[model samples]
Target: MEFAQALFLVVAGHNDRQEHLSRARRLVLKVHLSASLSEGESVRFLPPIFGEVRLIVHQFLDRLMHDSGRPIPIFNQNAGSLDRRMDKAEFDRFADAYEDQHRENIAVTGEGPEYFAEYKIKAFREIVDRAGIEVNRICDFGSGIGNSIPYFRRYFPEAALTSSDVSERSLALGRQRYPEAGSCVLIENNRIPVEADSFDVAFSACVFHHIPHREHLTWLRELHRVTRPGGLIAIFEHNPLNPLTVHAVNTCPFDENARLIFARDLAKRLQAAGWASSRIQYNLFFPRALARLRPFENKLGWLPLGAQYVATARKV
Candidate 1:
């Protein structure tokens, strides 16, 4: 098929304003798939940007197909060249569901911390500090609505920042709210679009629980691929051991389907992904009523009953 024909085939269903962008992303994915399969043999035939865009689309398609319980059509084609499973209708449903919800409710102001502050951003900062990450390049993986940007900046102001997420709308707002970010990537899949060994410290807060358990390691490997040797990977998740955390996620609109992961399980996933010296720390030991107790909470690191816990490991 012609390039235009393939692009059109990839974006056939969408008739909205985003159809153009939809086609663009698919094209990136196609070119990326070709280059990946052909290796350097296809470099002369494709653009350099294909390498980056393919990672995003490949990840995106994996999520969509996995969710739809069907295979996406893109892979069946020569460019993707995998299986013959084709279900555009199922793909559309998954795509729509993946879009951002509660856009207005998730906003953050430059004057104050955003919605995540209630979870004690200070504890997250403490985890990064404890990880001993050098203040250089930082990647905020699954950076929903850019809520983590402010805290990341506070923790490593001099570090170059990149915020990545699946929802373009969320990323758009993230860029608007935090212009200091050098790159805002719209990630559709488990893979991060950045180059390998690109980040000094990579962090994701409350993102993994949203991902299916089966895909966790795949994404972790992606995180591992992009992180520099000896770089820190910090993963923060809701503590399933905490009843209050369960109640909150059950009630939260965005988290209706979230499966809160335990600290040990997450730590194991990190260990299996080739991360070394893995350490887990529980934080947010106090409710807002006991906010004053946060200071004392630091000394209670021995306790793993906090509302959330951060799993840190070095990419060795």
Candidate 2:
């Protein structure tokens, strides 16, 4: 009787150990699957048997998920790659869900993607109007899906608008959205497919940050080459100095590889690229909570605390 009781206890203990291991495996697999589908959350709980090995398991899972052939959520996909350039292929992947991702990322600002797009175009128009520049032809450089097309049409109805981007799929979507655009040019080999001195105004909305810093001068020079002498080159970019802007970029899936530039730094880059009379003006000073204070934002451009900044230069 004593021997039988001992045997029964041992077998039951073995079965319980097996069950724990099975449960732990299922939990790890669940976490791994979730990591593949979305940005992973913190691993807080594990089977008690894994007490000492919990940290090791976490590290192993991180490496495994990173190598799983998909973009890791909230992390730059190029972090481990040799080539860190944000190329056409990367943007092409983002083209389909660009607007939805953008809208979600900027939801904290209490505005839609369209609002941001329209505001940048509106700011560009105001800059040219103040300078008394007559823009007959406009180049929407880096015009992803032509988000600014409608606003461009609204602001400069008479100007012939040409949109350009590195991503073919984005251009396809843009064409679908706005067939009335004068032209959609594909950028190949890091070159804008247009003749020299083709446009009176070359505008880029929140595009430079995605570009590798080494290539900024090349594109800037390209923009300079495309714009007519004395024409405007206006660039809108997120201001890194703004905490809110930093948070927005950090959370934005598309901006995972973004390298935000200071307004002053962009001005210097513009000068080096053969642009003259470069100036930086900050905007979007107030969130929706302070909508009443938006009228005062224009006056605050010199403060450098706005969510974004527009760097404008003349091709002289």
Candidate 3:
């Protein structure tokens, strides 16, 4: 229909085809080093989203002289009405569909510790692991469809878990997928739904960045409100330095978009929320482009703003 819509379809179609995911990762890695880039690289190999989408589709289809034998999945749209760029109510509407899409993708993609190794999930896992604080109670603040829920359960089977979001539908999906436990609780549309001074550790995965900076402060406040006075709050957010992040924030392809965020700003917001970082880690050190490069970015604490930022703060 519209240019952005059609463009998204082309890109998404290629992404849906499992074979292309590896190619996409390869290209992403290739562009990382200037020495690695091909001089006469044909733009044809580029994803359809790289150029005018409809034109790419037409040309590609004609070139094939028939269907490409690839079945494209339709785009998901529960968050079309929500604007993460807005100063308020970001991701409220879209979380359900967002969670659904990602949950399925993870299930399909996860082969082992490195399944979809090039993606962001592995980074989140590392963040959760390093934030190492044990508590009887756990809370995931922006637990989308419970992707983080399963990860939490996998790591912390003994702890009681709580998952909450502003979107009820998203929370419902988390409930559906999360292992049933007599001790767990699922909450929706309720900020800081957990009891005050309750949890020993509270975390949000791949969230924070989705909220506009204005609302980001409030999220920090809520993180503080729910945890015990000295409990820990961990936030694993997107890598600001990633080229894909720049593209998505500028052109997220749907009516909704991701808001731009940086670690310094996140730290400032945390301070404004009356919290201070006990431990801050910038993770997923090597950009997917540098997969061949050893010692991922976080291994070098010298560069704090390298990729993903995971901050564990104490409630103050």
- Give per-model TM-scores: 0.63, 0.74, 0.59
lDDT per residue (tens digit) for residues 94-171 in model 3: 655663344343332223323222233444445445555556887777665665555555556677877776656666
The superposed Cα distance between candidate 1 and the true structure at residue 149, in angstroms, equals 1.7
Off by over 4 Å in 2: 1-83
On TM-score, the candidate that comes out on top is: 2
Q: What global local distance difference test value does model 3 have?
A: 0.52
Model 1 scores worst on lDDT over the 10 consecutive residues at: 72-81
Q: How do the residues 83-141 of candidate 1 rate in per-residue lDDT, one tens digit apiece?
A: 32222122223333333333322322111234354343456556657666565888888
TM-score leaderboard ranking:
2, 1, 3
| Candidate number that wins on TM-score, 1 or 3 | 1
Superposed by TM-score, candidate 3 places the C-alpha of residue 147 at a distance from the truth, in angstroms, of: 0.8
149-243 in candidate 2: lDDT tens per residue?
99999999999999899889999999998888779989999788888999999999988888876778999999999999989899999876565
Q: Every model's Cα RMSD, please?
A: 20.6, 16.2, 11.5
